[model samples]
Target chain A: MFDPEAIERIRAKQRAWEARELREFLARQPESRADCRTGSGLPVERVYTPADIAATSFDEIGLPGRYPFTRGPYPTMYRGRLWTMRQIAGYGTGSDTNQRFRYLIEQGQTGLSVDFDMPTLMGYDSDDPRSLGEVGREGVAVDTLDDVEALFDGIDLEHISVSMTINPTAWILLAMYVALAQARGNDLGRLSGTCQTDILKEYIAQKEWIFPIRPSLRLVRDMIVYCADHLARYNPINISGYHISEAGATSVQEVAFTMANAIAYVEEVTRAGVDVDRFAPRLAFYFVAQADFFEEVAKFRAARRIWAKLMKERFAAARPESMRLRFHCQTAALTLTKAQPMNNIVRTALQALSAVLGGAQSLHTNGLDEAYAIPSELAMKLALRTQQIIADETRVPNVVDPLGGSYYVEALTNRVEAEVGEILKKVDALGGTVKAIEEGFFQREIADSAFEFARRKASGAEPVIGVNKFVEPPEPNAVPVHKVDPEVEARQIGHLRAVRAKRDGTRVAALLDRLAREAADPGVNLMPVTIELVKARASLGEIVGRLRQVWGRYVETPVF
Target chain B: MPPIRVLIAKVGLDGHDRGAKVVARGLRDAGMDVVYTGLHRTPEEVVAAAVQEDVDVLGISLLSGAHMTLIPRVLELLRAADAGDMLLVIGGVIPDEDVPALLALGAADVVLQDTPPDAIARRVRELVAARQPR
Candidate 1:
């Protein structure tokens, strides 16, 4: 055993040698001063040593799967299993999307992610007068459980994980999923998936909300409690920053606003008398990995550290699982360019690499044609292959947190945390995220940021490769755009009409009436009634319209 | 002249509204009245809003690739409401091959995101001008 003083002396000498080498390297290229900054614009330094990490202790920044899991939530991480490969799927009707789902699974996709059409997301039926012409056009339209049953027809509920990107009426969709699982004879406890039931972000970024803030929050809490009690494997709320970042918030605002919303959810559910440890474990997050490689990496790392710390300190979660912030990521669709559409493949691949390196549990890569339209099958295959290449070929996941402890990355991580901390404080001061959203704080911030990014692109400060710089005029004849089935709407409407004509209309009406009464009951959880309504073949518009009758639709009161 | 009132709505389940919001804001900035009927609006609601607001134009945005289906329904609603005089415009991630068909189906014009807001506004003004017989 060596003496402590001797060991200390050896370490100091080693540090001095590294400094000397770095100084010599920098001196050789004096013009290339290693100035550093985070993706969110916070300044960073070229080097960090004991002086920088002096305050961080073993207790504060512990080992993987330990308290305050700054490094990672899992012990083995990707060494044991690769991140879940979930490609966002939905197009045409439920049956069409169902086939796509089965195809994706056969192609080695580990999980399923559903993209709903505008009418479905807005809680309208396929045949709703307003929903006409739009059914299954943008995404799969599911007006009733019949559609949901068709969407997951061949898929075994117990085996595959599903993620539904629906909000506002998330409870309705979740009910559909549960009913489908029940019909399949799968134990609800065994079935797993995620509902992006984040209402605050809906107000902040997506704007697909139906109820006013308080009631919307009540519904969110209801799902959290219900899922925690019933379907323990399911992720109740996927607190999302993807839309926020895509909608134009900077990386810092994306993380800050997302965390603020997450905090709001935590506070609300806790206020509703649910124990934090019971449900926090299943609470997942969805974030965007943008073009900024290292910054995006740092944001992910910082998010983990901050969330773990919050869980331990703020919520006092006893379970390590509760503290572990499991997240799913998708490459930023906003960063993809319609000009040089091919470049998007590279853009998506790089963003996805950042997500894996940053330790995401699940990931989706955007198709190259996303900026132009819904991705053609060819483009989608390429997107899936990009993730496969990164996983199998790159060997990036060979080491856990491969970019961990890099001077630039660590410094960037610290800077991002500092900036986001300031934002969180502001959100907290505004009486939390709900009040801030109601007051239009988050929306105003995103709009301003979006405007800035656009202005920057126009002024040539931020270069958009094909859009601004390196412009190449597209050839007169490029790839033919993918054609959607023009008859899709007519066909879907016909099917819906037949379903309505054949189903006992009186039974459907009675079920809907029961739903209306249950929704009106403040104490009554609407999920059960929603399940009954869906089982009775009640359409989405009727279900949401009923709730809308009880809880009037939200009118945005602009906070000036 | 009173502000050029425009009603914007997403007819189907395409929840992508970034373009819709940007265009709404741009039109508002361009001294036009903009009312965004948030996602999943029915054609009936849109037509009623157009009739009630007496808007000069209706701009519909869809990213759900459902514009082909959704646009015709909105047009039919307009015709039913006898508000066909109000110009109907559409935009979103539409395929170039589908543009002519959408126009033929009664859309005054199909604007893509790549097209500048000013160009779209100018087109709106032109349609309004043409409707007035010079």
Candidate 2:
């Protein structure tokens, strides 16, 4: 923010300097490329000056911990407490992932994030025919509370924050988590973690939906209300742009689509008579720290500013906490190359640096071998060490929003905010998120962007180190990938069958019937009933299947 | 002649369909007719769709590490249905060690992540051309 006179003088000097100094320099050494753009295809100028951010107001880029927190969410930020190094770890059975959890925690990780197998994520039992050959492969497979208990066996429920990367059956997992905590005599209010309960994103980009849009929103609302009332310290929903970005959305689309989904969720919860402030404070976000260093930083800043304004103006949220936009960022997995896999470590480091400078509250630095499979133990440790080095060795986080005053960053932040606003306007014009999703608006937009990126990479316009530019001979089996035990599926299914045999069959049936009945009534919150069912050892598939009878499954009209 | 018909299918629980969608668009842009069978389709469903669509190439994208189990099943179903003539291309985050196994199981080609869509399209064309009785 500069005075008009000063800005005018700066613009005049820039022109004069460009006419003489830049002309001579450019004549001697012409620019490399005529068209230079960021990863999102935004134009990047030769240089940024004070005139670039002249239009931005000082208050718009306010101090940390203040309203419209473009700088950072908290005042001290990393200076007060380093971001939670929550590396996601899940594979094989529950005990198998539990070992990884203990290993990561012992390796100085501050938080725990679980990655469920397809069965658990899609609300299928490990033994379901659809879950055939998929059990405990991609991530851990949990059939009931017994599996969840084994998953978090030695981990302290109160001290450690757990984030579950489950969407469709997120409510069931939340219910299982609550039941686990109750059985362990842990205080629900003191329990802390996040369930990625953002269902609209599931429909938009992730394509992991069980129920139709309306009923999915209902489940999200129930989780928000249930967590707000009971688990005060827990984050009920992590509105994610990570999956959106990974699914080929540009940086702007990632923010716009996720915020649109966030708005829909807020409306759903608030319309159900819950106050915005009650649950808004616990509303968290997840984003990807992509390759474009400054753009990723600017995107984070712009996202915070937009969200603050939206909460205060649109939703009428009163509390400052409700206005703050806190997020967990994982280094972009799509950017990692399988060719020279070691190069991904450098990419992840730079991306992690961008995330920290952008003021992410929690971070998950992806492993180098992620392009192949889930990271091995050594790779996960390397990823965690990347965060540690950034926090302890690098003094970049010593200052709050270190890039806040940079003209380029501020100008880019303004640009991203404007672009996101335009997209949101289009969504609103299309009758909001659900309506837009129904029309395949988000899907088409993301697919087009993805296609464009693929075309660019194919043509060598965007050079990926090991892929396009610096070509390398194929090295077969160079990187040792972590393989899930082949017997894991059989073991998980046997455990599931054992759990079913042990639990009371009559009570489980009764709970499922009641859950289905309550699910039919739109007024009833499904969390309590779902919790009762999970407590009764009703499997995830049974609960979701019964509810599917009432609220039919969602079948998306395929959009490429 | 007619445009190359390719059916890009995601035959598993993995929802990472960006690769599949990009490849589909690329194939379409490369003057091919591409049909995507959405997400969460089983091997049986995928084989049925491939047979019904009668496409020259069927590209199955799987990222859930279930490729070993799922791809073999798809190959089995294709043989059972006498649709083994269709070019079965496997794509996604498939490991290098498993590539030979997948190829041995009758997969025409195994495309890993970061293969440009056009390259994938070209590969599909080459595979289909080789399969043709010229």
Candidate 3:
């Protein structure tokens, strides 16, 4: 974005300075390492100047809220209204998690994000044998409409935006949510929330899949179509890179794989006769704000620019809202340490700062105690306070895209965008995301990256302050670990049984039969019938089981 | 001598297999025959596979907080199958307090999160060596 003559002058001056002053300093003191690299293994230069970003054009790094939104998504980002502070909370029964939700809201959390337990996430009811000790261990267990109602017991659904972190059973959860709203007579058009129905990421990174690839994509298409028609303000699918990053992908792979999956979704929906602008506006994204501060910021900026270009040129989405890439970011949980637990607080604060500086629309700062288990109440409070401190005290948000024009950041952003383009080209050559997934391409890439990172840390090349460097004696019970009650499984199962015993079994059966019949037909959207099945008290397992009978389950060949 | 056979299994619905896969590859690189059971395998399925594969070491990797209930069940089934001699090594997000109980329940060792893969491979070698006839 600099004038060529100005850049040439700057380059000549930089070379002269390096030759004279830099040579003497380096000869005497020398650099710390032979090479410095970001977490993605991108080389870091000793300094950056106008010459670094000389090749970039002004239009590519346009103003906020404009096309090629490399700066930020909005004209007045956090200055207008701060990013939503959403701490994902779940463990134990729905009511148990609801209490935590209310506690977070009382503690100044702006938005709600639900974390479903394995059973709920995998489409198993609390009573299913597969749900055994896992009913509510990792997250809240939702079996039916009653559990969902209890999960949101005292919360106002209209005002607060909700994000459900579910994949395989996301459509069922959406149905339960819509059923809850419909039963409460809340306006469907006013429901603002996001269902992380991005099933492509499941095969790529998360490893949480129910139906096979094509069928899963079909379910995602059904959700997008249904939500675009009904839930006006709700995001039907949150195309996510968060789990991909958490599963050991580099920041570049995270964005590239997620975008490839997004492209696949857009293609799937459009091929099914849905308009691009119709559903694309409601499409949201989720990414991780990793520990590399400037790299994370540059990654977010590059991600937004890549998405904007994709929407404007590739998909032909006309609406500005369709082109604008809004994302929610969570601080890297893998960075937290089980060794010096308290150090995680500082780590989280800095990571959250990077996310805010990157202009995330919503953010989740991980609890310091997350390395052990679901975080304790005190840890969650500390995590929330970290966000509050950044928003109120840091003054980082006063200017939109504070690091927008930094030569280093701009150059890094361009580099990240280029790397993502290369990866996407590979995904395309493998015949798109599903084909690549079937070929185990994404899985192998992530596994290799994860191994490389582990090797680096193990060899002391990559230093984790509390893990490999400056180690200390294990502090037993340094932080209170949030323990899900052992009796949660039995109680949750009893609740599921009560609901089943009270509801009309025949009607539930008929509704499930209709669901299976409709699921057998590729032309039908399953959301409407699924909602009816949930309203009739068909458990999450029941609905998913019927669909499984129709569509079949997905099993992956081991990659590693 | 034959290479030490290692079966790294994810014995629950938890999908956090990054650690498991890395450890599996690390052990494989360390010259062990490692087989990963992918994801979503139940405790019964895990035990059955351990027996069927005739693995020398059954490494159970659990991050879902279901270890307290699931690990013991795997141990119990191994005993019932008369394969109690197989080395049982636990890994992933186990708390410090739970380590003692797990060890007391006949677990050869409990490797907490971020223990270097090379260290894990060394420990497995020691355990296998100890199990051999003197």
How far out, in Å, is residue B50 in model 1?
Answer: 8.0
Error of 2 at A109 (Å): 0.4
Question: What is the per-residue lDDT of model 2 for residues B25-102, given as tens digits with 9 covering 90 to 100?
Answer: 888888999899999999989999999998999999999888888898999999999988889999998888889999
Q: Per-residue lDDT of B1-134 in model 1, one digit per residue for the tens?
A: 66678887766645566677777776777788888887666677778888998888899887766566567878888888888788898888776677899888888888865555566778877887778531
Per-residue C-alpha lDDT of model 3 across residues A35-73, encoded as one tens digit per residue: 999999999899999888888889988899998888888
lDDT-best of 1 and 2? 2
lDDT of 2 at A300: 99
lDDT of 3 at A529: 91
lDDT of 2: 0.92
Q: Which of the CAPRI classes, incorrect, acceptable, medium or high, describes model 1?
A: acceptable
What TM-scores does chain A show, candidate by candidate in order? 0.93, 0.99, 0.99
Which regions of candidate 1 fall more than 4 Å away from where they truly are?
A1-38, A44-55, A58-60, A502-507, A558-560, B1-15, B20-61, B69-91, B100-111, B114-134
Best by lDDT: 3
- Order by DockQ, highest first: 3, 2, 1
Worst 10 residues of 1 chain A by lDDT: A49-58
Question: Every model's DockQ, to 2 decimals?
Answer: 0.34, 0.87, 0.88
Query: Considering TM-score, which of the candidate structures 1 and 2 is the better prediction for this target?
Result: 2
lDDT over C-alpha atoms for residue B13 of model 1: 47
- Calculate candidate 2's fnat: 0.94
Query: In model 2, what lDDT does residue A159 have?
Result: 95
lDDT of 1 by residue, A334-399 (tens): 888778788888899999999999889999999888866676777888899999999999988888
**Greater-DockQ candidate between 1 and 3:** 3
